[model samples]
Target chain A: MWFKYIMVKLVLQNVSTLRGIVGVLNDILKEAKFKMTNDGVHMSATDPAKIIMIVLDIPRTGFDEYICEKEVELGVSIEEFYNVLKRANKGETVQIENIDNKLKIITTGKVTREFVLPLIESIEDAPKITTGEFSAKIVAETDIIVTAIDDASIISDELVFKATQGNFEVAAKSEFHSTNLNLIKDKLIDLNVKESAQSTFSIDYLRRIFATSKLAPVAELNISTNHIGKFSFSATDMFRMYFLLAPRTTD
Target chain B: MWFKYIMVKLVLQNVSTLRGIVGVLNDILKEAKFKMTNDGVHMSATDPAKIIMIVLDIPRTGFDEYICEKEVELGVSIEEFYNVLKRANKGETVQIENIDNKLKIITTGKVTREFVLPLIESIEDAPKITTGEFSAKIVAETDIIVTAIDDASIISDELVFKATQGNFEVAAKSEFHSTNLNLIKDKLIDLNVKESAQSTFSIDYLRRIFATSKLAPVAELNISTNHIGKFSFSATDMFRMYFLLAPRTTD
Candidate 1:
């Protein structure tokens, strides 16, 4: 009974859901601490520079099986975890458990494969953000934003997001070249504007966050002038992830 | 009229076919000379180490449009050409031409994009391979071979191929681990062995050569003991390419 209380097991019917989540977190954090509770799994971490913070919550209903007698913290290298998940083929179920301070990942498909990675003690403190009241919010197709990011990336490394009552625009510029993607209200899934807002962010961070677009079809964006911007992806109620990025002050 | 005679233009309906071809060539040669005639395009080059040679031929009938007044050689960096081809989206039409000693690539789909690469002088002589008489030939599903290579790569850096009168086998071994993929006569599309043979080759080379599995469904392998092994991939008579690798003697 004591050993059972200390152990936790999670089974995911489709590995890609977890794979996509870790892929996004790996971009900003080299290591992450996952808090497993009866409710679900949650992780919060920021980049070394504190320019980006990611918060993830996957409810217990999302997993095929979630067993936890007591809350536990599992800290592991994001890189190693990602590498292990890469070995899981499509339609494979992934089983994760901890034994003797080592995390074991077993994928069951046509054949079963197991990978073991050691857990580490995470001491880094999570950054606290006092978010400002957002003035504008826009929901757009994930693929469209990914395309816009790629198009602007060819011109500059920084991207500017402008939201007006009529439209939302993503623009980038260099010395001689500039590209802009304009999406009108008719093109978006939803649009809300209390006041017009504009902000600039690093394309590098934006690209990595959006790389998980395949996991979600739509993205919800919240912005306030000269403040942190929040971009979130979610399914109906299974999982939700939001990334907050600080804007460039000079822009 | 003279400019027309000196210039040649080629158009491919699907960009991925050429993309896949150049992707394989870029693995071995930095620069290569393309001989363009009314009949087709041919390229022959060997790695700098002279341990592997690749010969490629894409017939004129493979293209949607092919124009050549006279046979000419277009020499360019294979690396750069491969990079440019990567930009072409799926289902896009790729058009290539030579203008003022510069090679021009244009892809037409949602938008027309053009890229220019400088032609270089290719002075390296192609390696002549008097292929040894092959005693064993095996044709298997490209995907199966790819999986076998990936499995063996996990245990060792080199792979061994064994053929007998009844079956063909791919095997690899390390100090503590070993993997083997055995295909009997019924398992393979075709297997013929005049005499039993065993050979070893660098897994690094085999991996790259097999990366083009997406371009073809079946792969034909020809091998002889202690000699060069030839692996070829093609789609009927439209195009054919083969890789010849010298086997390790000490094995």
Candidate 2:
């Protein structure tokens, strides 16, 4: 038991990366299982309703100090972890260690603060998705998508994403108000269309997912007709996050 | 009735001044009666609990366009007025007119937005306080008091202000922690101690009042033993706001 407790210990030069990751996870999950391996820390969780799945990876190289004797799983309340991380100030170093069913977090700066949370029993592993054959992929500046989402949210709960041979569009319409954002291939960072496809998704989920858009400047979107939409972004070189959301059916 | 409708027509070059004024009033009164005269717009109201009285004055010179054919009493929900003012973008001009029984608020920018709120019957005029002779007065940088309030708020819901011949102190004590901020006469912008005095006040009220400290750079405080405390600040040259708060009894 003592040896197992010492197996996983890591220190982050800055807590913001983990904070952003936890912010995204906490939006879709109450509790999450994080797997710590020699390579990195990883988590894949699906909301209870099975409408969304989030996969996160933070490479071991990103940590200031990383030591893992063997692979280990740490299950914790995401909300609690996020709350503790939020207390960290800029330039503070965050240290994490596992000891006797407790997760210890220490932040060192001008002042040192420590918080502890009891670890819970590990839940069933998250099911991984075999990447589907997406008909179209579009890459755009994160601000464009974030701004489009904000504009659409003013009028409707769902947004329609359309990819055609020459342009991409995000639009929403209610009985009284409508907003449309059209980006031609020349305007986007990159755009690929095997065949024209359109999908509608909940603005609620997109809003939560993109809340951390400041962590990354660009996002890649994969979509197909009336199917799941996959969005991916890398925060600096430290970590990458992926979100899979099921599309809403339009009558 | 028709003549009264046209009596009050005022335009503010920048809505931010009124926004800041309404922000402070809305914190204390849900429904406020604003008296507009050729001199300016003024309001004096006491909280329902009678624990705090706020007097606000905005001179006619502050308004970009002041056309008052006659003095008019406009009574409206402070909350609704505050919400509409919040919608104004920076540099947007705000036009206010008493039309019939409604208050018309128009914001002109790149886009023009208009909101109408029905006027309600005016409440009884606020009771004016005859200035009292305080034994001590202290003038300090607003940042000092604002910071002191924030520090005390972490420990207790009430703060004790002690003024002596040479210095002044703001302090709070809780079961586990205590915070004290001591400022000597030389450290303050100005300090006058005719007779030493001490008073305890609700931190909740101070916190709300000081939230608008950005609008003012300095504040003056008057205190007497176990009596009302008067705190006043000017939000730029546009307005002067005074808060008179009754002290909390101490054992």
Candidate 3:
């Protein structure tokens, strides 16, 4: 009932993608689709396994607003709330409301603590942005490039993706054994080649990029020389993901 | 090389906290740490704003003994290695080794996953055979009892608690505006009320009985009530914990 902060209506997009993926949603929410709206942030996802559509809503403010009217209680906070919701059951009760100027949130089956945050300008410019021209496209001479890298990536700490005029490959080295796979076929996704360009990316973000296989799909490209590369994603939030490495000098 | 199903060893005692805290570790390890060990598990923890710990390790079987005379490269199963370590760090290099029969786990970063677990067999069947009739002690009973019933607890779905006249009072409630300060009072250690009479406990174990406090720290109690209570824990994998409620028809 006590009012703390007020704000004018402002709407913005929210998107996020998981840096690493156990599933598709993790990839979409944490990496590519970062969004934030006036009402709050929402994640509209479909479980690849069950193939069930999920619509999740998180209010903008972190407070509990109750209607002495209908008997319902909900709570949420900005800092840790998202982390909690990320793990909550899709169908669990999630509550949010605007009382006077304060917003309240609540989640079922968990204790609640009211956190009143100062509502700031819900402007679009405040979010971190990535400003760099990215290459429009590249031809993967070999189709096995990404698959090989991702496959070998399953064993090594980092994926050494190499692409060039004639060959493309992904490889990982360990004290016990080194894994290297070649991509000599397929031009749609992987270009048949020995090597053209090179870049080292976090398997985490790569996992996310792969998540978009169903949407905003990215075509394959072979990295010829090992060079650090960058990628950006915008939705509710903006991200600048970086991958670094010297070209695969040996292989 | 030969391949076999991948198996990693992880030993964590105390499953009670896993319901709430392990998720946090899941996030940090995704990029912060990776690896497994033959000896057990090891990692590094830190106070960096969002990051809590960095875990790293290798499986005991990962160590290649065939190249004993020379510095040999380590060979790890693709999916097996990825599946095991993916649960830890998302982007970091992870190494694991097995010497002899035991696995030795090591990682790069602050080691934080550490705790002592109480086994039910060791804690249950005895005070050399636990006796009945007693008094339970507490540091500040008013704080726990009063704060428990406040409006903050209105959203607390379950208020499961058990207490004896003199021994101890433990409560866990999953509701909004909840009063959990006492249930997880990380401050106090042993409350001297040891007049063991009767006690009531909560069913949900996610609610911490005492925050980072001692587990099974014996307290005296004056059990005069007609209710049965239980505190069950495993010695080997303190991970699985349970508290049963005994309806107190008579006080």
The best candidate by DockQ is: 1
RMSD of 1: 10.0
- The superposed Cα distance between candidate 3 and the true structure at residue B14, in angstroms, equals 30
Chain B TM-score, model 3, reads 0.23
TM-score-best of 1 and 2: 1
Per-residue lDDT of candidate 2, residues A122-161 (tens digit) = 6777887776789789998887788778766655799989
Compute the lDDT of residue A108 as modeled in candidate 3: 38
How high is the DockQ of candidate 1? Answer: 0.05
Evaluate model 3 with DockQ and give the value: 0.03
- Model 2 stretches with alpha carbons more than 4 Å out: A1-251, B1-4, B174-177
Using lDDT as the yardstick, the better of models 2 and 3 is 2
Instruction: Estimate candidate 2's alpha-carbon lDDT, on a 0 to 1 scale.
Output: 0.84
How does residue A139 of candidate 1 score in lDDT?
A: 96
> Could you tell which candidate, 1 or 2, scores higher by lDDT?
1
DockQ-better candidate, 1 vs 3: 1
Q: Give Cα-based local distance difference scores for all models.
A: 0.85, 0.84, 0.34
The full ranking of all candidates by TM-score, starting with the best, is 1, 2, 3
